[model samples]
Every structure is written in structure tokens, then in C-alpha cells.
Target: MRADACRNLDTLLQTGAKVLARDPSASITQIAAEAGLDRRTVYRRFATREALLVALFEAKLDEAERVLDEARLTEAPIAVALHRYVEGIVPVSRQWPLDFSSLESPDHVTEKRRQQLRARLSAFVDRGVDEGFFRADVPRTWVRKLLDDLVKLAAHSNPEMEPPKAADLVVEILLRGAGKQ
Candidate 1:
């Protein structure tokens, strides 16, 4: 409710995400210590580890939604928008790295957000088709799938390849396949 309280909650969530990412078995007390907040504060915000995990999941999605908005997926030129989206999403995918088979199921609100994100991305691909950037002969769904996989690949940045370079490579491959032109 208050500014300081909101900040504390955000810190707890952010630190909890990093800590849990590194060690999934991390405890609430550990999260609070890492976040520099009192254990009671974390307990007040989240009654249990599952509750904290659910909050982390929602926080991850919330951040991703913001990144997508910043990408200007619909308004920008397809090439520029694709580049922005890839660059923006790489860190997010790396940080959150959602496990579709996770034990914790997403709540309805999170599921709806996922659907909304997918629809936005699908629309972007359709726009690309309309503008002749992508092959019109290919199904929009296929194109969207291709883009999703490529972005994921880019997100798994290799030690030899920096994230931006990896993202650029993905964009190039998406535009022009591996085969000789």
C-alpha cells in the first residue's frame, strides 16, 4: 500500500526469483536476508513458499508484458520491431525460463496474460506477412512458431556469442534460412 511497502515487496520478489533460480530449494528466510528485508515482512507479504513462487511467476510475466509493450510490436516496422523484441526478451527468458511442466500451475490471470502475449505476437507475424517481409505462402502459425523458437534459441546465449549478437543472428536466420540464397 505504501511506497516503502511496495518497494519491499518488489525487492523480495526480485531477490526471490534470482535466489530460487540459482537454488530452487532456497527458503523464505534466505530470500528475506538476500532482499535486505525482515523475515516478518516477507511472511506478511507471502504466507508460504508456494505463495511466494506464485508471486514470482506473476512478476516474471508482468515484466515480460512491459518488455513487449516497449517493443512496440504493432507500431514499429517489422524488422525493427523483431530486433527490439528479441533483444528485450532474451534477458527475460533467461531469467524466468518458464518450465511448461512445472509442478505449479499458472493461475487463470497468468494464463490469460500468456494468451494475450501470444495473440500479440501472432498479430505481428501476420503483419509481417501482409507487408511481404515473410513468405505469404507459409502459414502464420508456422511463422509465429519459427519466431518463438528462434527467440528461445537466442535467449540461451552461448559463452562464445553475446546476447545482442545471438539475437542478430536469429533475425538474419529468420529472414534468410541457412541454405544458400
Candidate 2:
């Protein structure tokens, strides 16, 4: 494809995501219009609705990573950092479009990102243990898994659920397993 065509494709994908995110029922014509391109141009890049949705899903994941990076997680207190990270993830999960069932299905890229986040969060908990904020006996691996499982559980199960409450429950469970000094 030509450079201009590639640019148009990117524009269409970006604007289409915004359009769908704002109104899950936005039409192809509406998306193309928002991108300042014609329907034919949009279709030239994305052959089907599923293709568009999948691209948008991938874009949303990138946006999530950007949000996490901007959070500056390492500078804050462990609990504070964890809360903010979980809080950031909550809104993303709630906002993510779920109309496309296949696109919403778990993908390798998504799993890898989640695993990376788990590692980072587990490290934070381990740091807390070293600093005496968390119990000494806690396994960092469990802390990591709890962050992944609980935040996701809250997302899929309850959009109206409080993330902090979810975080608290996860923290309590892990701490109990670790036992007090």
C-alpha cells in the first residue's frame, strides 16, 4: 500500500475505535465519516467488521499500556501503587467494547501483557515484605497471581463493583496465607 493509503488505514482504525467506544452501535458509514474518509476507503483497509473490531481491540491494549507507564508506578508506596494500577485497569476494562465476542476472547498478546503486569505487581508486594509492610512469609508469586485474577474477576463479573474493595479482599487473602510474624 502507498504511504497515504497506510495513513488513511491508521486513521480509519483509530477513529473507528473512538466511534465504537463512544457508541457501540456506530455504523461503518459513521466511522468512515469520523475518520474523514469514505466508506470505500475504510473497507479497503479492513475487509470486514470483525477485522475492524480486532484492530480496535489491539489498539485499546496499547492504550492500556500507555496508561500504566504514565502512572509512574515505581515511585509510590507499594499499596498506593497497586491501588492506582488496579484503578487504572478498572476503567479500561469497563470501557472496553465487548460487542464483538471473538475479538473479546483472550489473545496471546493480551495474556502476555497481563502476565507482565502480574510480575510487576508481585515485585511490589515482595518489596513490601522486605520493607515490613507485608508479612514476611508471603510468596510473591501468589501476590502476582492475585492481582491478575482479582482485578480481572472484578472487571468481568461486576462493572459496578468497587475496585478498591476487590483489591482489599485479594490483599487480605494473600496476607492470611502468609501468616503474621
Candidate 3:
């Protein structure tokens, strides 16, 4: 694709995420107008609304995979890995707010990637427990869920906060509970 086409696609995807996040029922025409692109352009690229959503989700997943790779969860020290993952993911979550659970029918590749990411995360939590970064007494699933929830909350609740700041807040909250120390 040419530079202009790539730029236009990025604009459409970004604008689609924002508009659809605000209103799931938002129309393609509205998204195109918001993106400053012609509706026909979006139609040319995506055959339907569902196609646009699938592309958006795929873009999000691609970013997530990159973040996970950069974090080096298996090799990095537990604290460092946690912070890096949170910092990297907060922006991606904010940019593409769609929830995978809401997907009507995820392709096999997407589902496989999601499973791989989840397995890696679960393993990281197990490692944290074994390494004493997390208490062994706590359920591993609980810890994983808490971390996921904290990241989502940080991204959505504090939209004004920068990713690093939001990450710091999330890491602090996860490592040390809200209770007075």
C-alpha cells in the first residue's frame, strides 16, 4: 500500500475504535466522517461493519503481541516485567477498547493467539508466586484476574493519565493492595 493509503487506514481504524467504543451501533458513514475519509473508502477496505470490527480487533491483538514480546515476561525480573507489560498495554487498551469476550465469532488464529497470550500470562503469575513476588497462598487465577482488571481500570478510569503514570499506579495497586500499609 502507498503511504497515503496506510495513513488513511490508520485514521479509519483509530476513529472507528473511538466512535464504536462510544456507540457500538455507530454507522460506517459516521465513522468515515469522523475519520475524515469517504464512506466508500471504508467500504472498499472493509466489506461490512463486522469486517471493520474484525480488523480493529486484529490490530489490537498485533499490538498486544508486540508488547508481550518486548516485555520478555519469561526472562525479565518479575517486577520489571509487570511494569513493562502494564505500561505497554495501557495505551493499546485505550486505543482499541473492544473486549474480546464480546466477539461473536473469533477466527481460529485469533483464538489461538489469545490462548497463547493467556497461557504466557498464567505462567508469569506462577513464576511470580514461585519467586516470592506474589504470595503462594493466593489463588493464581485470582492474581491473573486482578492484574487484568487493574490494567483495564487504569486505562478506562484515568484516561488523562499517561501510560507510564497509569502503569505505576497499576503496578503499585497490584503489588500492594489499597489497604493502608
Candidate 4:
């Protein structure tokens, strides 16, 4: 695809996410208007609302996967990794808050991507346990779940909160609750 085409598609997806986030029932025409593109252009790219949504969902997963990979969750100190993950994921989670379970079709690729992420997080939690950063009594899976929930809570906060602040708050809260007691 041409650079301009890619940029236009990205704009459409970004605008689609924002608009759809506010109104899931928004139509292709609404998305096109919000994206400042001709309705024919959006229709050319996405024949249906479900197609647009699927693209949006895939874009979100791709972004999140990239962020997680960049965090190097298994290569850094567990604490450092956790902070990086929270910081990186907050924006993606906030901007493209699509519920995977609600997608009409269960996407294998997306599910696999999520599983890979979960594996990295699970390993990080186990590493923390070994390093005495996390408690040994609690199951590592429980720690991972707590961390996931904390990150979600932080990302789900009022968009008014700055990303850095949200990240810091989530890390602090997770550490306080899941750290050695």
C-alpha cells in the first residue's frame, strides 16, 4: 500500500476507535464523517460495520502485542518489566477498549496473541517470586491475575488522568497489594 493510503487507513482506524468507543452503534457514514473521509472511501475499505470493527480489533491487538514485546517483560527485572508493561499498555487499552468476547467470531490469532502475552506475564510473576519481589505463598497465576486487573483498573480510569500518572498509580497499587507482606 502507498504511504498516503496507509496513513488514511490509520486515521480511519484511530477515528473509528474513538467514535466507536463512544457509540458502538455508529455507522460507516458516521465513522467516515468523524475521520474526515468520504463515506465511499470508508465503504471501499470496510464493506460492513463488523469488518471495520474487526480491523479495529486487529489493530488494537497488534499495537498491544508490539508494546508488550517492546517491554521485554522476561528480560528485565520483574518490577521494571511490570512498570514498562503497564505504561505501554495503558494507552492501547484506553483507546481501543474492545471486548474480545463480544466479537461475533472467536479469533484464533487474537486468542493466540493474548496467550503469548499471558505467558510472558506469568513468567514475570514467577520471576518476581524467585527474586523475593512477590510472595511465595500465593500462586503465581493469582499474582498475574491481580496485576492484569490492576492494569485494567488503571487504564479504565477517567481519561482525564495522564498516562504516566495512571501507570505509576497502577504499579504502586499492584506492588502494595501483591508485594511481599
Candidate 5:
């Protein structure tokens, strides 16, 4: 694409992220209008709400890597690092209502991005096992799958409106299943 077109695309994506961050209900036209473009132009780049959202999700994941780095990886506990997995997931969850689970299988590129994150978690889980933090028998792959399922649940649930008991339910599940034995 031409340099000016590239700039316009970037502007559209930035404007869309801003609009969604503030209000996920913000329409594509609103995003286009905010970016000084037409709805057709916006869809030209994005194709669909899910596509635009996946783009935003990928952007958020990149930001999460920065956050994890800032958290100082080597110094942090394995559980804390594991929490970073959720830390990054929540933004993606917030950006689009069903962000975590709505992820389509065809989106190989983004799926690989998530797999990279899970790989990191797998390594961390292995470390936790060595240090006696996590259970030796708890398979990292299964834990990754479980966390993915849990984030899908957490995406739409209201932990604050609900009792603290609800939030602890998830932690308890993880603890019992992952705690050192």
C-alpha cells in the first residue's frame, strides 16, 4: 500500500482500539467517523467485527508482553507469572465481550500467538514443579487448556457484583488441581 494509505489504516486501527477501550458497543461507523473515514473504508481493512477485534486482541497481547517484562520475569514467583497469563487475557476479554472464547480456529496467526503464551506458561509450570510450587503430575498442557476455559468463563462473569466466594471458586479449582502433592 501507499505510505498515506498505510497511515490511514493505522489511524483507523488506533481509533477503533480507543473507541472499543472506552465503549465496546461503539459501532464501526463511529470508529470510521472518529478516524475521518467512511464505514466502507473501515470494513475494507477490517472485513468484520471479529477480524477488527482479533487485530485489537493481537495488539493487546503485544502490550502484555511488555507488561510481563516490566513485572520482571526472573524475580517473580511462578504463580505470579501464571497470573500474567490472565493479566493479558483480561484485556482481550474486555475489548470484545466474548473475546477469549469467540476466537475462531481459522485465525491461525492469532492462535499461534496464544500458543506462544501457553508455551511460556508450560515452561513456568515446569519450573514451579521443580521448585515444589505446582504439582509434579499436573500436566502443563492440561493446565493451559484449563486456564483457557477459565478465562472464557471469567470474560462475562461479574466477580465484584457476585460474592467473593465466586472468585475463590476458580482459585480453589486451580489450587486443588495444581497444588503440590
Candidate 6:
């Protein structure tokens, strides 16, 4: 695809995410209008609203995979990897805010990718625990859930916060609970 076409597709996806996030029933015309592109442009790429939604989810997964790869979780020091992952993912969580659990019938490929991402994250957490960055006593599932919740909270609740700042806040809160110590 041409550069301009790619830009338009990206714009459409980004706008679609925002519009659909606010109102899942939003139409293609509404998304196109919000994206400042012709409705035909969107129609040319996406035959139906569901296609656009799937594309959005795929895009989110792509970004997440990219962030995870960039963080080098397996090779980097546990603390550095944790911070890098948080910093990279906060913006992605903000940009593609769709909740995968809400999908009625997600595509197999998407679901597989999502599971792969989760496994990678779980492994990273385990590494952190082994390295003494995370408490070994805590259930790994709880730690993972807390990380996910904190990232979502930072991204959605503090919309104005920069990604790095949000990452710092999340890391601090995760590593050190709200205690007098």
C-alpha cells in the first residue's frame, strides 16, 4: 500500500477505536467522519463494522507484541524489563482500549495471539520473582492481574499523564503498596 493509504487506514483504525470504545454501535460512516476520511475509503478496506473491529483488535495485538519484543523481557534485567514493559504498554493500553474479554466470538488467530502475549507476560513475572524483584509468596496470577489492573487504571484514569510518568507510577505502586513504609 501507498504511504498515504497506510496513514488513512491507521487514522481510520485509531478513530474507530475511540468512537467504538465510546459507542460500540457506532457506524462506519460515523467512524469515517470522525477520522476525517471519506466513507468510501473505509468501505474499500472494511466490508463491515465487524471487520473494522477485528482489525482494531489485531492492531492492538500487533502493538502489544511489538512492545513485548522491544522490552526484551527474557534477556534484560528483571527491573529494567519490568519498567520497559510498563512504559511501552501504557500508551498501547490507552491507544487501543478494547477489552478482549468482551468480544462475543473472537477470531482464533486473535485469541491465539492474545494467549501468547499473556504467556509472555506471565513468564516475565515469573522471571521477576526468581530475580527477587517480585515476592515469591504471592500467587503469580494475582501479580499478573494487579499489573494489568494498574496499567488499565493508569491509562484510563489519568488520561493526561505521560506514558513514562504513568509507567513510573504503576511500577512504584506495584512494587510498593500504599503503606506507611
Q: Against the true structure, what is every candidate's RMSD? A: 3.4, 6.6, 2.2, 2.1, 6.2, 2.3
For residues 1-181, could you state the per-residue lDDT of candidate 3 as single tens digits? 9999999999999999999888888889999999999999999999988788888888988999899998999999988998999999999999999877545677777778888888998999998988888877778898899999999999999899999999899889887852123
Clashing pairs in 2: none
lDDT scores of the candidates, listed in order: 0.79, 0.67, 0.89, 0.82, 0.65, 0.88
Query: TM-score for model 2?
Result: 0.54
Residue pairs that clash (backbone atoms under 3 angstroms), model 1 = none
Q: Residue-wise lDDT of candidate 5 within 1-181, one digit each (tens)? A: 9998888877877777777766777778898999899899878888888787788667756765665565444568865655654555554554443344544443778778867765665666567778887677778667656666666566446534232333345445776787775
Per-residue error for 95 in candidate 1, Å, reads: 3.5
For candidate 6, lDDT tens digit of each residue in 1-181? Answer: 9999999998999988888888877899999999999999999999977788789999999999999999999999876787899999999988998887546678888999999999999998888787778887788888899999999999999899998898888889988852113
Candidate 4: where is the Cα deviation over 4 Å?
none
Model 2 lDDT-worst window of ten: 97-106
Q: How much lDDT does candidate 5 score?
A: 0.65
The candidate maximizing TM-score is: 3
Off by over 4 Å in 1: 1-8, 22-40, 100-103, 159-163, 178-181
C-alpha positional error of residue 90 in candidate 3 after TM-score superposition, expressed in Å? 0.8
After superposition, candidate 3 runs with Cα above 4 Å error = 178-181
Which 10 successive residues of model 5 have the least lDDT summed? 159-168
TM-score of each: 0.76, 0.54, 0.92, 0.85, 0.58, 0.92
